[model samples]
Target: MNYRTHIVSDLSEIGQAGWDGLVRAQDKPNPFLSYAFLHALHESGSAAPQTGWQPQYLVLFDGEELAAALPLYVKDHSYGEYVFDWAWADAYQRHGLDYYPKLLSAIPFTPVSGPRLMARDAHARAALVDVLVATQQATEVSSTHLLFPPEEQARQLKEAGFLLRSGVQFHWLNGGYANFEEFLATLEQKKRKNIRAERRKVAQAGVTLRRVRGREATHADWVLFNRCYRNTYRAHHSTPYLNLDFFERIGRDMPDNILLVIAEREGRPIAASLVIHDETTLYGRYWGELEHVPCLHFEAAYYQPLEFCIEQKIAVFEGGAQGEHKMARGFLPTRTWSAHWLAHPSFADAVERFLERESGGIDDYLDELNERTPFRK
Candidate 1:
């Protein structure tokens, strides 16, 4: 088998078919991890050099066949990645070493957990990692990190000498629910009442929710969506990772993977939630509201998406990123993984030390979260 790596400086080199074909055949496929999805992010300017996520996608080829690929970036700052490394960056600063322009393998602005190392088989997967190590060394990047990979992939990376780091994100899994009521029944009485009241508030306020898909959704829909999208960032006193152009391009190019739940009052959109669905799971992505309607966030982000999942027979709903409040709505804590390789010996030593201590605290926290499960035991 012959091997080569592309800089991913141009979109054409990482052809959509070559990447999507591998994704479709994988056991646990996710649209967020697809070529079309990542490319749309770049082409639409959501994840670009200007936004600190410059494409440095790595691809491995064998003869005329595509063997493996990774979505990588030449990062200047860590804004979109949920995993915080600011302290490490500060440590690099204290030591007068550069951390910017390091190598990263992750879905830009996405914190959802799934596969990162894509390949036809284990041998190829392992070989791909070896290639990335050599590439990073040759390029003299400070380090390379793969965030939120599946457990097996993380283990293999650890075997290849990358230090393993663990984190938790909450997700809701369906367990033979005949309907949403059956799901709500699993929650404790107090929590169940709280959720019911939230949903009820939306209906009482004369708000109706509708879902729009892909090409069917209009540019006006995207325009309204971005307005709501920016509200969340503004509330937090920060800027949103994506812009209107990015949202518009994605909706045009990849409608099959997109799901928008629009909440309207008297036929006008007041709140919206944007989600992505593949074969098995629905990922709850960005959401916001133009109006401060009670329980609007839950109705748009959680209840609405959960209803769509059940109607479509999708197995799981991964509420994006961290939200302990998700527990009250039936989402449970699940372990997530990342693999790190730091070039500076002292910084590497300190990070590994911190990770060792952090893992214990994380384990205990997961145990505590599991003990408080909303589902009936």
Candidate 2:
């Protein structure tokens, strides 16, 4: 098949329908890969050249029909990408090398694992991989990285000579439970009791949660959600990567995919957690609170989503990124992967070696996490 690659600075150039059509054709379609979610990141100014994430979205065309696409970026820093490469960047700096402006294909600020390459078939996918390497070589970027790609794509990337790095995230898998209590019954006695205690504490504090869908959420709800979202970053003394406009865009464009769990006390909202979902999985994305209510975070961020997943028959609830605490709430450790290719041959070789050792450590860590699973045998 003959394919031509076009690198555009904006997603709108490819148009939502065209881009999303390719995404849906993939084996695993995710909301994060949706045109609205990604375009919102750029159009809302949350991710752009000024913010160190310059869009360099790659699209492949077979005579004007969009064959494949990658949500690529020219990253000047590694802040939002959950896959930590700061040590690699530091090694580059020490050797008088530049790592900034590296090519990255990922959902900005989202650590949830999903498809990074949206292609129709194996032929198109293979062609897309070649285009990625050629783009890195042609642009002369220090390296290219694909974060949170599915396991199959990781294999293709490996075959294409990209180094594979492994990480872990906790996710709750539905076991055909009829309700939240039935799900809890699968957990060990201690973990099950602890979870009950936590929920009881929230209830005793007079904090009630209301799950609001995107379309049902009012403007005031979004404003408060944004405030809570910003407060989360502020508490850590870091700047927020997303803004109100981005949330509003997703709410309007993909209303069915958005769920806001609002925590209220005395009939006044004090906290919020935002979840994004597709037909199969619910993703716990962002959360914050105006008042410190004990166990509120777990309730809004974990349990509520877990209940929603069971009620809606969603297969998985990804607890997001790193959190050992999530294990106590029935989330089990799951492996996530990323692929990399450094332009410098020597450095690439070094990273390959490092990844081999790191891969073993991740394996051992996953083993340990599994041994400590909160669920009953």
Worst 10 residues of 1 by lDDT: 1-10
- Candidate 1 CA-lDDT value: 0.85
For model 1, state the Cα shift of residue 261 in Å: 1.0
Off by over 4 Å in 2: none
Q: What is the lDDT of residue 38 in candidate 1?
A: 80
- Model 1 over residues 33-109: C-alpha lDDT tens digits? 77677877887788888887888777777876778777789998888888888888888888898988788888888
The regions of model 1 sitting more than 4 angstroms off are none
Residue 179 of model 2, lDDT score: 98
Candidate 1 accuracy as TM-score: 0.96
For TM-score, the strongest prediction is 2
Q: Which ten residues in a row have the lowest lDDT in candidate 2?
A: 132-141
